[model samples]
Target: MSKYTSFPEPGDDHNPFQDPAVTQHSSNTEYATLDLYNPFDNKNGPPPPAYAATAPSAPQPVVPATTPPSRTTPTEPRNYGTSFTPQTAVNATTAELLRKQEELEKKARELERRERELDSHALGPGATRQNNWPPLPTFCPVGPCFYQDINMEISQSFQHTVSIMYYYWMFTACTLAFNLISCLSLFCVEPSGGVGLGLAILWVLLFTPCSFVCWYRPVYKAFRSDSSFNFFAFFFIFFVQVIFYVIMTIGIPGWGFSGWIVSLAALKTSVPVGVIMMLNAILFTAQAAMGVVLLKRVHSLYRQTGASFVKAQAEFATGVMSNQAVRQAAANATASAAQGAFTGAAR
Candidate 1:
């Protein structure tokens, strides 16, 4: 033992269990301890014979997490009306079907409402300017008619019409007065207040036809074009009339002038010319006021429709009230539908 001498090498032929004294340190050595009877110890079958132990087993991993969304599952049902649809991740087809059904119901209710409204005092198609609001004609995705018709043709024609009308009114009044005077002077009792007669002839010959040419043709153009066809035509005719009015002012400077070229000879027939002048002036004045009022009405319509002034003014000037009614009706219809759906669901 002092020299660390070894005993005879353990015999290969001798079993350690049968020859115990030489293997006495085995109880204190490191080794695995598994219980053969434990289910988990099977390891798909059973632990190897050498690795078996007698201790109890550990817990399993098959169970899910302790904290999950399902932890607070509601004991009571959560109810919402059909309108308040809550789609689940699971059946997309069912969700789509539900959405389609709601849309169909909405459409049906709207149709029924339209029928009821029609049975009442509604005037035009969807009168009061709600559903009947015509979409602006366009050349794009929304509409088929080209806006060019309104922009290039109708608008221009409208302007031209206004201008032509202005000139036409001025010309008609002036021409009517001059022509009537000429005809009346023909019957004047003073056989030759002849200067009056001559003046009347000159008016029929020069003033009437010239004014007609100056005013009426342009008016035709205006109706066809509607837009500002020729502002100068307006200015030219207007300026000429202003000059005529000034020269013809109450003093009657032209009345003293030679011949019908410069006389109130048309006044020879008091009744007809007087009536003509009165009607002509009246018609012209009314036109001015009528155009202005209509323009204002059209502009208001444009603002409500989100249309630009440059586009056109074809819509009616009734929006604030009409739109509000549409909104209120839609809301009431939707609410009623929802209430009915929920009531049915509850039942």
Candidate 2:
């Protein structure tokens, strides 16, 4: 008589499928991962034939949730709500994927329920159901294994985009306020006072719009696309401006145009320069911190798309990925398939 027992005897680590009795047990698993792993194994036995139960020879039909009355589905708009598809692994389009995921989740839940029913009917919850599970060798990540998936890589990019939005908002506020106030001052002040009134007018009317279009737009696009080049360009322009402003603050009397009223006689030394110098120091520190943050973000994005920056110290990554990964050949292909979804490429 066949040893109906499915489990390997104790002290066996590698002989799960040796007993054919439990080999086919995972046929009912949600994603059909029964073949992936089997735990109960014994090396010393004749491989058992799978003990798959055969219904008394009748085939089962897959019944739709709601069968159509007669052949009227075509005429009456066969509204079975949403059509479901099995969630086998593959990259399907959005509509197909939503349907697929729903089916997989449904299957998983149903399998769990059936296991519960069998357990309750047979041994009950407190009683072990080790006999019920298929022989699995690997750790099974069944429920919510979605989080453990590499798919979360896409999810993380979304999170990064949110953070970039915050930065964009901050910069937007600074730019808008500075331009509005500075431009207004230019208009109100006399032409003879400070820099040329023509320059101020041009700065207000021209530079504000131009900066917004050229700099801010690209930065925003970089944030959305998670691209490396956009980030590098943004920082390069931003820090250049920061350095210029710092120089102007130190070189000019009041750290701003027309703010210095001190006479050369009163200011013999760079002693009055202390506060401005300190403020410049603080600005530099802030810029450095900002640069570090952008550096980290750009590094992460470059990992997504092969780009490099000075701060990205992962020599293995920046140096190698762009070269051996068939970088140029893959880029156009990836970019095209991704649609215009990627707003910009950075440095």
Candidate 3:
């Protein structure tokens, strides 16, 4: 008491330096306290406490456990936007592939059906569906006709000849029909109706079949076959028919009923008959022209075959020399001539 004054300081009651427990408590308080304003930190509030900074963060704001939308939903509308994800793209690609596969299957089935139909309808090898009636002739005449095996390789000139020949045949057939009708009309007007009718009937019965067999058929065969023999036979027969046509056109008065007879009957009886006859005359004239043209075409065909009078004579000689029947006939004729010559001398 003599050495030091007994005076109490302002913080003597809580002397933190003198008491360990006080010091420890003060440290704990300091650590727990937050600095609302700190010069060291640029943040709006004070920095985190040292312990909090050192410790692991309270498990980061637990992210919501979410599942992505399914792309495979059939009811979902297609998203055409550029924002589509990879999963959606994969689904769209798979769907498109399936659709295309279905389309391909349908097309394959259709093609298979068509192939079966074609196979069923197929007639024969090298034959088509168009091989029907009415004989659709090809534009190129030098080819196959109605018959499969029968084909002709003719020149353009020869084709023109064939066409003209067909026209001639048609004209001739028409002329024959016209002639028959005219004869019938003339017979109706004639005084001897029965006789005229009989003649007309006879002419129709005889000439119709005869002309077809002798002339038209031969010509048709010639064109179809391109046979030299058929051509020659047609020319000979047709030449005779043409002569008959001319004779019929002349009309022998009472015996034969013809276009000319009809015209004569028309002058004597009916104007209608005359008109019909005149029309017949026109047709006959046209037919004659056609015949002439056909004859020229026939001659052209003949020349193409290297036929001539000399060739004809050579053929005749060859045939006679080669044929036994012809040779026997010729020998008989020669013997008869000699016998007659000898008999005449003796008499």
Q: Could you report the Cα RMSD, in angstroms, for every candidate shown?
A: 29.7, 38.4, 18.9
lDDT of 3 by residue, 117-208 (tens): 56745656666543222255567555432321111223333555655665566566676677667767766776565665567667666876
Off by over 4 Å in 2: 1-191, 194-198, 226-228, 247-306, 309-347
TM-score versus the correct structure, for each prediction:
0.26, 0.28, 0.43
Top-scoring candidate (lDDT): 3
lDDT (10s digit) by residue, model 2, range 1-347: 12677555576576756555565554445332335334355543432233223214447897879856686347644446754454422435667879999999978866665665565567754774333222334665542211111122223444455455346435534533443343234334323324433443444465445554455555555555455556666667765644544442233443232112222211333344333334433443454455456646654754666555643445335646669557876787788866755554421
On a 0 to 100 scale, what is the lDDT of residue 114 in model 3?
A: 62
Off by over 4 Å in 3: 1-157, 220-226, 308-347
Candidate 3 has which clashing residue pairs, if any?
Answer: none
- The sequence of per-residue lDDT tens digits that candidate 1 reaches over residues 1-347 is 42465343554354557556645535533433333234454454765444456434666668875775574767755656533234553467788889999999978866665565465455655754232212444554554221121222233325444454445455545544644454354435335446544554665466555654564444344333442333235345745654553333321322422222223443554655444444433443443454344335433533443433232222222333368787799789999999999999999
For candidate 3, which ten residues in a row score worst on lDDT?
144-153
Q: By summed lDDT, which 10 consecutive residues of candidate 2 come out lowest? A: 144-153
Deviation (Å) of 117 in candidate 1? 35
Ranking by TM-score: 3, 2, 1
Off by over 4 Å in 1: 1-187, 219-229, 249-347
Superior candidate under TM-score, 1 versus 2: 2
Give me the candidate number with maximum TM-score. Answer: 3
- The lDDT values for all models are 0.46, 0.46, 0.63
